[model samples]
Target: MTELPFATTRKLGLVIDLDTCVGCHACVVSCKGWNTENYGVPLSDQDPFGATPSGTFLNRVHSYEVQPDHGAAQLIHFPKSCLHCEDAPCVTVCPTGASYKRAEDGIVLVNEEACIGCSLCAWACPYGARELDQAAGVMKKCTLCVDRIYNENLPEEDRVPACVRTCPSGARHFGDLGDAESDVSVLVAKRGGFDLMPEQGTKPVNKYLPPRLKDVAPQIDILAPFLEPVSKGPKGFLGWLDRALSALPGEDR
Candidate 1:
C-alpha cells in the first residue's frame, strides 16, 4: 500500500462558483481534448456514434433541481473532478503504489506505467473522480493540467488547467490553497466556499461557492402610484371638446 507525505509545499487546487456555472460542459470537452492529445494516453470511446456511448472522462458536470425553503426551484450545475485531498484515501489504498499524492503540490496522481488496473483507487475515492481508460487499461484522473501548468514554453496566462482556461462563464479559478493571501484563497473566503464532503475526512483542497439565492418576489417601485394619471376623465383640450359636444343637438349636459 502507498503512504501519503507528511506535508506538501503548496496546496494547489481549484475554486468553482456554483452560482455562475451554466452547465455548458466546456471544461469537460477541453479536459478530454488536452489529455488525449498531450497527456499519458488517449482516452477511449466505445461505440461513440452508436446508441450506447461509453468513454473515459476526467471531469463531469451534474445538474440538480433544488427547492429552497423560501424560494422557487433552482437548477444547480455541479462539476466534479479529483479533489487532491491532503489525506487521499485513493493513495493509501493502492496496492501497487501507483496512486500517490505529490509532496510538492498536494496533487494526487496515478503512475499509469505502474498501474495494474485493479480499480482500487477508483473504489477508494469518495467523489468517484477516477476512471479506467479502456484503451490504455490504466487509471486516469484530473492532473490539474500538470503539463500545461509547469511548461515554460506556454504563455504565462495559459498555464492554468484547460478546464479553467476554457470556462466561458469564468466559474473556475486555480491557485495555491495553502496560502492565506492567494487570489483563490481570498475568493473562497469571500464567497464562503465549502468542501464537497467534509465528513469523509479527505481534507480536499478544492472549494465550491454556494449558489446565491434568487429573489422570491419582484421588487415593487415606490413611485409607481405617483406616476399614474391624476384624473380618469379627458384632459383640458379633450374636456372642452366633450363639453362642446354635450351642448350640441340631442346631447345631455
Candidate 2:
C-alpha cells in the first residue's frame, strides 16, 4: 500500500451547485477535450461510430428525481468527479508509486510512466473517479488541470479547469477550499455545501451546495376551497385526483 504525507498547505477543489446545474454535459465534454491533449492519457474512445461508443471521461453529470412530502418533486442535476480527498484511497492502495498527491496544492495525480494498469486504484476509489485508458494501459483521473492552472503561456483568467470555463450555468466553482476567506469557501458556508458519502471517510475536498428551498403554495392549492370544482371543470374525486397529480413535483418529467 502507498502512503501520503502528514498534511498539505492547501486543498484545491470544486464547489458544485445543485440548484444551478442545468443537466448540461458541457463540463464533461470540455473535460474530455482538454485533458486528452493536456494531460497524461489520450482519453481514448472505444467506438466512435459504432453501436456502443464509450470513452474515458474525468467528469460526469447525473439527473435524479426527488419527491418531498410537503413540496413538489424536483429534478436534480448532479455533477461528479474526483474529490481529491485528504486521505485518498486511490493513492494509498496503489502497488506502484504512480499515484500521488501534491503537497503544494493537494491535487491528486497519476504518472502514467510508473503505472502498471493494475486497476487497484479504480477499485479503491469509492466515487468511481479513476478510469482506465486501454490505449495507454494506465489508470487516469482529474489533475485539477495542473498544467493549465499553472501554465505561464495561458492568460490568468483562463487558468481554471476547462469545465469551469465552459460551464454555461456557472454551476461549478474552483478555489482553495483550505482558505476560509476564499470565494468558494464563502459560497459553501453560505449555501451549506456538503460532501459526498461522508461516512466513507475520504474527506472529499470538493463540496456540493444543496438545492435551495422553493415555494410549495401552488402545489398545495389543489386542495383549496374545500376541494370544490368550478362550473366549467370536471367534478368530484376524479377532478381532485387530476389536480393533485398535475400539481405533483417534477411535473416536467
Candidate 3:
C-alpha cells in the first residue's frame, strides 16, 4: 500500500477568475498544442478537426447561466482542471501507485506505466478532472505543465503553463499556493478566492475568484425581485472564510 503524505511542503496550482474569463477556448487549444509533444506520449486524439470534434486536453472551459443578487441573468465562463489538492483523494485511492502528488511542489501526476486504467482515481475525484485515455488505456489528469514549468531549456518567461500563457483575458493565474506572499495568494486574499466544493474536504490548492456582481448596477424596480437569485441564501463556510480574509466588494471580489 502507498502511504500518503500528511501535509504537502508546497502547494502549486492555478487560480481562475470567473469575473474575467471570456469563455475563449485559447487555454484549451494551447494546452493541447504544448502538451501533445512535451510528454513522451502524445495525448490521445479522436477526430479533433472533424465536424464532430473530440480530443484530450488538460484544461477545459465551461459556461454556466447564473442570475446574481445584483442584477439580470449572466453567463459565467468556468475554467477547470486539476486543483492539486493538498490531500488528493485520487492519489490515496490509486491501487497501482499510478497517481501521486509531488511533495516538492505539490503537483499531482500519474505514472502511466503503472496505471491499469481501473478508473478508481476518476471515481475518487469529485471535480471530474481525471479522464481515461482510450489510446493509452490509462487515467490522466492535469500535470500543471510540469514539464514546461521546470524545463531549463525554455526561456524563463516561457516557462508557465500553456493555459496561463495563452489566456488572452488574463483570467488564469499560476503560482505557489504554499507561499503566503505569492502573487496568487495575494490575489485570493484581495479578491475573495474560494475552493471548489470545500465541503468535500479536498482542500484544493486551486482557488476561484467569484464573479464581481457590482459591475451591474443595483436596480430598484419590481422586475429586480424576479432577478434576485434564489441561491443567495448563505455562501456556506467559504463565505465566512472570505469575510475573514478581507472585505473586498462583490464586483472587485
User: Could you give candidate 1's per-residue lDDT for residues 1-253 as a string of tens digits?
Assistant: 3799999999999999999999999999999999988878888898999999999999999999998787578999999999999999999999998898899999888888899999988998999999999888999999999999999999999999999999999999999999999999999999999998899999999999999867666678877877977788886999999888988899474
Residue 67 displacement (Å), model 1: 0.7
List the candidate 1 regions with Cα displacement exceeding 4 Å.
219-253
lDDT tens per residue, model 3, 36-141: 7876367788777788876666778999999767657889999999999886899999989878988788899998889899999999999999888868788878
**In model 2, which runs have C-alpha deviations exceeding 4 angstroms?**
217-253
Tell me each candidate's RMSD, in Å, in order.
6.7, 9.2, 17.6
Candidate with the greatest lDDT versus the true structure? 1
Kindly provide the TM-score of model 2 when superposed on the true structure, using C-alpha atoms: 0.85
The best-first sequence of candidates by TM-score reads: 1, 2, 3
Q: What are the models' TM-scores?
A: 0.86, 0.85, 0.82
121-166, model 2: which lDDT tens digit per residue?
9999999999998778899899998888889899998999999989
Q: What is the lDDT of residue 211 in candidate 2?
A: 93
Q: After superposition, how far is residue 213 of candidate 2 from its true place, in Å?
A: 0.9
Instruction: Report every candidate's CA lDDT.
Output: 0.93, 0.91, 0.86
Candidate with more favorable, higher TM-score: 2 or 3: 2
Worst 10 residues of 3 by lDDT: 244-253
